[model samples]
Target chain A: MHTLHVELGERSYPIYIGRDLLNDPQLLGAHLTGSQVVVVTNETVSPLYLDRLLAILGERALVTEVILPDGEQFKNLETLNQIFDRMMHDRHNRSTTMIALGGGVVGDITGFAAACYQRGVNFIQVPTTLLSQVDSSVGGKTAVNHPLGKNMIGAFYQPQAVLIDINTLHTLSPREFAAGLAEVVKYGLICDLPFYRWLQEQTPRLLAREEAALAEAIERSCSSKAAVVAADEREGALRAILNLGHTFGHAIETAQGYGKWLHGEAVAVGMLMAMELSARRGWIEPAEVVAFRDLLRVINLPVAPPADMTPGQYLDLMGRDKKVIDGRLRLVLLRGMGEACIVDDATEEELVSLLETFR
Target chain B: MHTLHVELGERSYPIYIGRDLLNDPQLLGAHLTGSQVVVVTNETVSPLYLDRLLAILGERALVTEVILPDGEQFKNLETLNQIFDRMMHDRHNRSTTMIALGGGVVGDITGFAAACYQRGVNFIQVPTTLLSQVDSSVGGKTAVNHPLGKNMIGAFYQPQAVLIDINTLHTLSPREFAAGLAEVVKYGLICDLPFYRWLQEQTPRLLAREEAALAEAIERSCSSKAAVVAADEREGALRAILNLGHTFGHAIETAQGYGKWLHGEAVAVGMLMAMELSARRGWIEPAEVVAFRDLLRVINLPVAPPADMTPGQYLDLMGRDKKVIDGRLRLVLLRGMGEACIVDDATEEELVSLLETFR
Candidate 1:
């Protein structure tokens, strides 16, 4: 098992990467300070992995379970209320620890649930999906999607520990796995150029679920994320660069409805749009755009955005994204495949042209 | 204006207590780091104070207003959802500062909104009601109520500053003013015996809204709370004592349906219950219980709980309160008029006897 500490001082916690670590009592045991444990999972992953986790948890604490309905659509105040209701019903106090046991949706909801559950509770992410393990599971960013924008209601609450079991990836569909890779590729595009090149070289191995390569990818991606989060923990300035493709991605998701396109898939196309815009502005050469698009395509992600959405609609939707600062659209544009910067003055005309070209 | 600093290291903020400080730019000015500001208020307070606050905020940055329906029934995931929706629609980023410009309900919902808006945002509490000025405005306990329990969903996010405008209380109803005093009297019961005695002697002065006495009460309550919060900023252990009457109070509010009884009114009755139970357990003398109940009655607050509810129902409700520790009924029992201790193993039979006696 490999371990990386997200250096957030007292809020700092470990991200453990290995195969079958979910059943490892040592990893889960380190974060359990109390006797009451509530495991939050969605319907899909519960049937597959709940027993393994329950077995690991043993008879130490009273383990309560809240199984939510599956899908991004369920990620709202209503679903969040359900978790709160369960917490109230069970009389779970601040000392009660919450364990998130599913993909990004479950992790996000559970983290936020823990964040607001009695002012906050100790929550550990037992991520069961590639997307959660690679990206959502590490950062303190926990949120629920809104009808207007994706992830509009949330908090940046760090988890007690993240227990990532790579073996759980076997349960994910190939398409879902590819969707997660889009975020894995995101780390390379934003900060680590060498990692991007390495991802290009190791795509086949990662897709084939090769243990060593997949482990390396997850480790490097987390390290890059931890470094960025540590530097700008709240995503105030430098962290906005991490939203390289998220602005366009949020719009795409909102326009298409939340559950239709996976967040990673939308981000894949969004990254393509960002690169196309960067090329138009001469921030990156046309070839880097091709490289970015090719990598996303290789992972079976949607490289080009959907054609039906108009530039105006896209721009309007993007305007509603959380990244927009002071009502101005702040686009994360690339200097190269390895670097990105926030562009605050990008005009609607520029975005419209970029959207037109992509369509 | 009286000033009290909440001394929370980096999260520390000033509580400005006086009349007409809401329009005083210096209080809001020092905290305004960014250009974007979103003022959150409820329907009742908005028509009264939102415009004045908006005028003070001026055209600086992109100023937006979100008006939620007034009352505690609206203080839930649904209302919190509306605030997030408005924030997203306005493109309010993490840098945006939210001003909670109402009473305790508004301050809590707004503080909670700030806590969840992009993981967290800078929030200022411009408390209009006396209850908020004395209690909710200073502490960082921000939350939305749950269906099963009051404030079941929330966070302990500190604000940048708290501006208390005593002038706004001129418009407050007598019932509302009395509810605010219930919290004011709480400080005296927990750790400030002198303040409690002073309140005992000066009930009319406070109820009459004498500026000097009201200001002193607000300042003293804030100072005592500030000291307690500074000692335990996160409510780790010692802070639980601050919730002397809250276990029973939460039950009253939940059972009566939130907003049916003001938080302070429920707290007033709750404090009486605490005293009754404490006296029955030999934690405090019976004479102390009489004094506590008489004081609540002096303020025209409920001494006895509503007659409709059963002791079992109260037990069930209080059992679900967030203050419970390790499946035990953790009550902050008064040792005397001025001091209290957390008694974690209060027996249900003892509680039933006390409930019957009180009933």
Candidate 2:
């Protein structure tokens, strides 16, 4: 078991990573504030792990479950309202604790529900998918998607604690597992060069879902995300670094119509475009960009956008991104192989030309 | 002009309280962060003051307006989406500033919209009504109502600045002006006894809409609310006192349906109920309750619940309030005539019997 604390002063909580840790009563129980609990999971995840958690929670708390449809397409206000509907119908109040138990889609929506329900309530994240375990669960960026853009409506609300069970990763389909690796690799690209090299060597073990390697990756990724979140908290500046490939990634997610492409899959191709932009900026080595793409491909992740998506479509989509300031698109481009910074100076013609080559 | 700062560290901003101050561009413009500005007002207020604001905002920033329906019935997620839809459709991004123009309902919905739109944007509160200028515009409590309870979904998102124009109150209906005074009287009841006496002395001037008395009332009310909000931003403990009659008041509003009985009118009756509860608890003299009711009556505010509402209905509704903890209904009851504290030990039977008397 590894315990990593997200040092956010009064808002801080620990991320517990290990196998079969879900059965650990102290860890999951410590975060539960009041007797009334609502476990927010999706349809798919509920069938697999809901009973186990219910048993773990025991007869102590009056527990209820809201099982939503399992997909990013359901990650909108309408679906979010379902969670609220259940909560209000059951009369959940400020003291009631919400438990989000599923992948990124579940965690994101559930976290958002917790944020808005009664202005705010305590919630815990038990992220199952590798993408969520390592990334979304650790940072408190809870949101639902707007049709205009991904995560267009949300809050920077933190949770009481996040408990991860590596055992759930065994249920992930091959494609889903591969998608999670994109964000995993992102941590190494943004800040940890040694972790990048380590990941290059640990691909086989990571792919096999080997417990030790998977745990290490999740911990390191969460640690990186926690540090960035702690520094900025509100993404005023430094925290935007954690959004390394999100500008282009959100564009892909929105264009493809969320749930068509997994968040991590879109992030993978977005990272590639960012690297290309970094190369164009004369900051990153061409060899580094090629290597990054090669690593993604080797891990069975898509390294390019769909062939049909035009530069104009990408431009139109990116213009709606939340990071845009005063009509200028602010992108999280790579400074070098292990550094990322926000750049808003790129012209439309330059971005369109780069998108042309990528497509 | 009177300025009262809601001291929330770096999140703090000035509350400018005065008459005919909407045309003061410096007060409104200094708070705006970016060039793209969106003014969120309601139909009732748009024709009255929107053009004046548009003129004051000038050509320095690109401005747009989202004029919504008038009334609290429109203060829901569906209406909130209208703001988001317009902003997204217009390609408004994070740098865009939102200015809320109207009464409490507009300020609240707009503030909550600003809080959620791209995880928040810079927003200024341009409160038009006396109720909003004295109350809602000062505190950072922004929310929209759910069917079950008022303000069930919302955030404690502070605005960049609050610009209150007392001149708009001239257009308010007689009932609307009285509703605003209910909140003004509440400020005196919950904490400043001297202000209560001051309100008593200035009843004629206040009722006549004498500019000096109205301004004084607005400033004093805002200052008291600000001091309380500053002490407890998220309402962990100290801020709950500010709710005073709100629990019963919310039930009245929800029962009657939003916009049927104005918020302040419901609060006036709720304050009487709270005073009765305070007397029942042996904390204050029963005579004080009558005096409080007399004051509200003098201000043309309702001093009793609707004849149709039963105590059982009140119990069912108050149970849904956010103040409930661990399934217990926690209420902000008075410690004395001018002091308030939260109590959760009251029996449902006692409450029902009390409600039977009031009804």
Candidate 3:
């Protein structure tokens, strides 16, 4: 097992990564301080892994279950209310604990639920999928999607701990696994060129879900995320670069309706858009864009954005993204193949030019 | 104008207490960091003072308004969502600021909204009524009530500044004015013996809306609230003492239906119950109870719990209050006038005795 600490003062918690750690009683038990626990999982994850986690929890606390529907579409105020309803129904107090047991959607919603439940509660993230384990699980960025923008209504709440059982990746569909790689590739593009090279070289091992390579990817991705989050936990300046493709990607998710395209799939296309924009501005060579696109394609991630969006549609949607500072659209665009920077200087005309080329 | 600073490390804000300060743009403008603002008010306060506040904002930023229905009954998640819906509808982003333009219900709801909107946004509390200016305005405790308890669903979010316009208090009905005095009296009973005596002597002046007495009352109450909040912003321990009558008060509000009795009115009766409990426990002399009850009666505040609720109902409801620690009800009962202490050792037998005697 590998343990990484997110250094957030008193709210700092550990991310425990290993095979079958969900069944490891010590890792799960060490963090929970309260006797009342609510395990929030989705229908899909509940069917697969709930029993394993429940067994690990044993008789440590009075555990209740709030099983939400599986998908991004269910991430809304209504679903969030359901969690609160359960919390109130179970008579859970401020000292009660909540465990999030699913991928990013479940984790995001549950984390926000914990953040708001009785002002705040101790929440542990038990991320099952690669997307959540590598990205959402480590960062305390918990939010649900709004119709206008993704994660528009949320809080920057840290969890008590994150328990990652990378063994759960065995259950992920191939498409789902690749969806998580988009964020992994994002780390390489933003801050770690060496990791990008490593990703390129280890594509076969990552695709095969080899233990060592997958573990390395998850750890490296988390380390980079933790370092950035530690520097700017609230995304003041440097952390905005982490949203390398998220502004366009969140727009894609918002415009298409949440459940239609997986978050990573949208991000994959969005990263390509970012790369294309970078190349247009002569920040990176055109060949780097091709190579990046090829790597994404090789990993079975979507390389092309949805064909239906007009530059006007993209403009309208992206303009409303959370990254817009003082009403200016601040996007994370590449300065070079391995360096990303927040670019707010791009005009609508420039965006249209890039969109026209892409289409 | 009297400006009292809440001494939280990074979250500290100033409370500007005086008559007609809402018209002072410099007071409001100096605290605001962004050019986008959203003013959230109730239907009750909108017709009275919303325009004056918007005028003070004065083309400084793009201002949007969300006018909600008034009353504690409306302080719920559904109504809170209306604020979010307007925020999304207006395309307000993280940098957009929110000004709460009403009493405690408005301040609590808007503060929670600002806390949750895009994780958080800068908010200002423009408290019109005496209660909010004295209590909610100084403390960063913001919440919307749940059906189960009062202020159950919310966050501990501070504002950029609190703008108090005592002139707006003239618009309050006599019953509402007295309701606000209930919390004012609580500050006196909790920690300030001199203020408690002042409240008793100045009830007539307070009821008459004498500017000098009202301003002094607001300033003194705010100072007490600020001191407690600065010490324990998240209600770890010391802050719980400020919730002296609240555990019982929350029960009364939840049981009798919100808006039936204003928060301070419910708290007025709850405070008497605490005194009665203190007397029964031999913590204070019986003379203190009679003196406390007389002052409340003179101020037009209730000194009795609801005749409809049994002791069991009170117990059931109080048990669900946020002040309950590890399933134990920790109540703020008086050690004597202006000296409050948290008591967890009160037996059900003693509570039943006190409830029966009061009944």
The candidate scoring highest on TM-score is: 3
What is the iRMS for every candidate structure? 1.6, 0.7, 1.0
**DockQ, computed on Cα atoms, for candidate 1:** 0.72
TM-score of chain B of 2: 0.98
Q: Could you estimate the TM-score for every candidate? A: 0.96, 0.98, 0.99
Q: DockQ of every model listed?
A: 0.72, 0.88, 0.79
Ranking of all predicted structures according to TM-score, beginning with the best and ending with the worst: 3, 2, 1
When summed lDDT is taken over every stretch of 10 residues in candidate 3 chain A, the lowest stretch is: A55-64
Query: Pairs clashing in candidate 2?
Result: none
Give one digit per residue, the lDDT tens place, for model 3 in B165-246: 8899889998888888988988999999999888888889989999998899989999999999988899898888787788
Where is model 1 more than 4 Å wrong at Cα?
Answer: B23-26, B33-35, B281-283
Question: How much lDDT does each candidate structure score?
Answer: 0.86, 0.88, 0.88
The DockQ for candidate 2, computed on C-alphas, is 0.88
All candidates in order of lDDT, best leading: 2, 3, 1
lDDT computed for candidate 3:
0.88
Candidate 3 lDDT over A57-176, as tens digits, reads 868546789999999999998999999988887788999889999999999999999988889988999999899988888779988887778888889999989888888999998988
For every candidate, give the share of true A-B contacts it also has.
0.81, 0.92, 0.70
